[model samples]
Target: MTDIGYIHHEEHMRSSDLISDIVIGMSDGLTVPFALAAGLSGAVASSSLVVTAGIAEIVAGSIAMGLGGYLAGRTEADHYESERRREIAEVESVPEREKAEVREVFAGMGISPALQTAIADELAKDKVKWVDFMMKYELGLDEPDPNRATKSALTIGLSYVFGGLIPLSPYLLVSHPHEALLYSCIVTLICLFVFGYFKSQVTGQPPVSGAFKVMFIGALAASAAFGVARLFG
Candidate 1:
């Protein structure tokens, strides 16, 4: 009989940093412009004004959000690099102590004292690997991508623009703001529910509840804005 090899497979759904940026950008993009357009519809008769205002908001919002993402990414990368340099210095100055920390990490995993010492000694032979291993196990930091800042900025900015376009599209076609608002409301509400549902699924929350929550919040914000505009206009 021929020998057979067994393959093991595991599958899991995870939410990534990119997904988080998209959620932040898209959620605000969809809700903010939607609320603005709804409010303008209450105050004005011309769809042209609503479309113009919505476009302006989308441009400003995307830039502001992208800048925020870039700053956050930069801070994260900087923090990690600073910590890594400190770890390297510690490794050089107190080699024995650093080795002890390595053994401690293995010990925490239920490794035998002898095995821990053996593994730590082996790791200490290579300074770079030792420092990197310590960074991961002791400091709990993985190296951030060098281009994380630029990538985050672009992702958030583009996602915002894409989401912002949905509600504003109806206003471009309809001459009357009120008619455009009706179509915008229908389209945006559907999108909010769908977006929230998928967002919750990826993030491991209850999908239906999350969808309803998102939808309710969007409607309430727009309603409040519209009411205010109508009252004052």
Candidate 2:
């Protein structure tokens, strides 16, 4: 493969990590608001209440998701930087020890000592490549772009709000609670299935399985909320 092709392949694989964030946002947006609307429908029996609850859920949840994501991204960046600096220092101060460590890392992976030594020697000849390898293999970390994390958070938060709107739209547009709920359920399930299929594509899993998993979690969350509302209301 060409260099660009390999890079693209790697990027595609890395994109799977964002799926977790997307799923979290989507679940939060759809489940919480739908449950709130459902609960309000049960307690107040008003379409207005359902719509209001959904609006509140979307606004509050979006802000929370965005702020949470930003803070988390910042924290990860700081930690990565700190660890990278430490690795760099070790490489500078203890070249021999670092070389042995690298050799041992390879040896533990079933490579012969001689080959490991040669590989480490060649790798260590380039400081940037050596550091990059150590960070990835030894520390189990990849350098993340700061902008990417921020964008991820924003996308996730928006996705959540978007997903949530699916269940609430019927209530906003229709006056009948039962019909609204039914329509909401249908829309929510379709969205869940689509999201799951996309997630499966990213992770190389079965689309049906992922769809079911998403639906199951959304159902559980909404059900739990409904139960809580019943008990308290």
Candidate 3:
């Protein structure tokens, strides 16, 4: 097992939808509860209050975020199904019109009229395939994954719980609100930077810049919340 300098392997692909769900969930999970904790810290003297409130917010936030993801997934599925049905109906009811539309598609791509007619005619022979092609190229839609709704719900909910725990962890260890806030800020800010760096890597942005950007936004939100709380308290 000593000959592994450079190996060739097939490239693996990952799902963009899952990545999007994680980004949506984790970003909010990290920021919102963090800001809330910072604000609560400024207002109260007891760490217990901050911890209790933070846990409550985390539970509520996870459920709300998960439900939102599930709804979005279901809506996407519904829209795809509706369009699919309409496409099927149109194809069945108007073969000639659909054939002409197919030719138009090829024609727009700079194919010669004769070639366009030939291709379109061949495509029109198979109603199912033609409908599928039209759905993809003309309507710009892909079939939705059947498991998308349930998967998105779980992913977003779990990610929120994980992210919310970072800032809330410090309050569990300390007795005073300010002391807990100090530790929470340190831990959460580091996690945010790391999270943003990896997120940028996946999204094809500059890692350092993205990290700073995320960190700054979180800091700004927390600072604003803390200031408001202190002023009102």
Candidate 4:
């Protein structure tokens, strides 16, 4: 079929980029700040200290997490570029070897030797297409979006700030640390459960189980921190 005659199906699907950012940012954001607040509440009588410490942690965590995400994105792009260059060199310097490699891929896929040779020959004629094909099928690498690093950094940082606010919001209203913590626990646990449910739905897992699991983890972290702080205090 002609290119114009073919229907593009990609428009129907959604990108998982934003979801990934939210997951990374929110998971750490919720868990870390919640634990810190819980720990502080156990040790301090005033909610203001907890609020101050929580804000500091959220700011630091967001920056660190965002930087890490940005670095990861850059590393992936660099790795892909390096592999692309290597593939191009290999294709130029060792044409037969590259063709054989291409044939091997199709052969493993159950394509006949004749068809493999034909496809390899056609692929070899176009250097860019050949490298792209090798990059995907042979190396299992995709061409990342150019703005992925910046977008991922911003998404993760902002999501962290948003998630971190949930547990800390109670402290802003309540005067006592213990009272704030009680409310924070309720709010954070509910948010974690709901977040996990929707996350599981997106990832094709059981929503009920995921919700419980996430809630348990959040509770566990906060409880552990609170227990330790109380022990020392």
Candidate 5:
């Protein structure tokens, strides 16, 4: 007799909060600063000016993105807490109504009425479990981690800084803005394509198309910025 063994390893990567934060930060970081440098390159003669402006923008953008991430995390936690409190209050004041809701949850799950009542009655005896059940099943909420806000802020901010540096690095080494812009365009577009490729693989999208799409967006934004700056300058 031959037996087959099954393994449960997942093939695709799942995105976490960190991944979400990095995407938010890196996407804006790479695109915005690339466009800014392209615009400045068209308008300015000195690479020094472009480098300075890019650094300042990266710093400000990182802070703003970090703050936004922090606020979003805090809001999520607060909303979950608010819902939990309401659930707790209902469990105490109108328990029958709450239990009926539990029955409804089971009914939706194809549980028979008699079995649903028995299960609801059994589940209600433990207030903590009852409240937890409602919070998850009825309200669709999970408790937020205490450090989620801080972690999100740091992750997004750091990612923005890292991404912003890639486009700006050429300016630091070169004296002419136009020359630096050429190098920046080459490197940043490559980075964008690579980033998108990996991101697509993780999220289960078509990698080659995703890479081209990302590269196109960054190129378009930079081209538009450079064109506008050249026209205005």
Candidate 6:
């Protein structure tokens, strides 16, 4: 039973974190570069320039996403560690107060006062477990593995490059620049809609609405960029 419980907990934690990372990585990788390509394709006449921009966007965007994810994850880990230390200090120095707070928290959640006191007593007996429990239940924080951050960043960045390629591939193969631009736009829009729908599913929102919202925003941005470029060109 204990082994089963541990396995379930570990699996849940890992799967949840993985889904979040994939969604974030794919979202950034696919949308921004696609938008950049779509907008630039309209303004530029040369296939060489379009290809150059697409390649640049993929490489630059991947690095940016990777670095950003790594730094963000590192910062979060640092903050969590700091807080955990603080929590330990408080538990050691002002144990009665912290215990009382824990009792109250449980009581407020409808645990009987007697049970809450008993639970708190048991928890306080094991200082490490008590601190961990407090962090999870009271503070709603889980200590993330430091290495996962780098892995997440690299995964996301790579995903972004892949997603970005979807929109740019048509332009690379087709000879007609105008047709390429149209096909790229179509592909990008379709991908965006799908991405938005999946994002909405993961986030518990209306899928169609979310899809439309992203599409509208991307369309607006692409249109604005195209208009500005044409005016300047």
| Predicted candidate 3 versus true structure: per-residue lDDT over 15-95, tens digit per residue | 398998898889999999999999999999999999899999999999999999999999999999999899899999998
Pairs of residues at least 3 apart in sequence or in different chains that clash in candidate 4:
none
Model 3 residue 14 CA deviation in Å? 6.4
TM-score winner, 2 or 4: 4
For model 2, the run of ten residues with the poorest summed lDDT: 5-14
Q: Write one digit per residue (lDDT tens) for candidate 5, span 4-123.
A: 585577675798888988988999999999999999999999999999999999999999999999999999999998998999999999999999999999999999999999999999
Local error of candidate 4 at 66, Å? 0.2
Best of the candidates, TM-score? 5
Per-residue lDDT for 30-122 in model 6, tens only? 667666766676677776677788889899988888888888889889989998999999999999988998997898799998999899998
Instruction: Tell me the lDDT of model 1 at 89.
Output: 98
Residues 1-233, candidate 4: write the lDDT tens digits.
46987777753224398898998999888999999999999999999999999999999999999999899889989999999999999999999999999999999999999999999999999999999999999999999988899999999999999999999999999999999999999999999999999888777789899999988999999999999999999
Give the distance in Å from residue 83's predicted Cα in candidate 3 to where it truly belongs: 0.5
Ranking by lDDT: 5, 4, 1, 3, 2, 6
How far residue 66's Cα lies from its native spot in candidate 5, in Å, is 0.2
TM-score of 5: 0.96
Better of 4 and 5 by TM-score: 5
| Models sorted by TM-score, best on top | 5, 1, 4, 3, 6, 2
Q: What are the runs in model 4 whose C-alpha is more than 4 Å off?
A: 1-15
Question: What residue pairs are clashing in model 3?
Answer: none
Tell me the RMSD of model 4 versus the true structure: 4.2
1-233: candidate 2 lDDT, tens digit per residue: 45764533344444554777786788688777877776665566678778887888799898899778877888888889999999999999998888988998998899998999999999999988888888988899998777766876787789788878889999988897767877887888788778877777777788889988988877777677667777887
lDDT for model 6: 0.80
Off-target runs (Cα >4 Å) in candidate 2 are 1-15, 227-232
lDDT of 1 by residue, 129-206 (tens): 999999899989999999999999999998899999999999999999999999999999999999999989988899
RMSD per candidate (Å) reads 2.3, 4.7, 4.2, 4.2, 1.4, 5.2
Flag regions of model 6 displaced more than 4 Å. Answer: 1-15
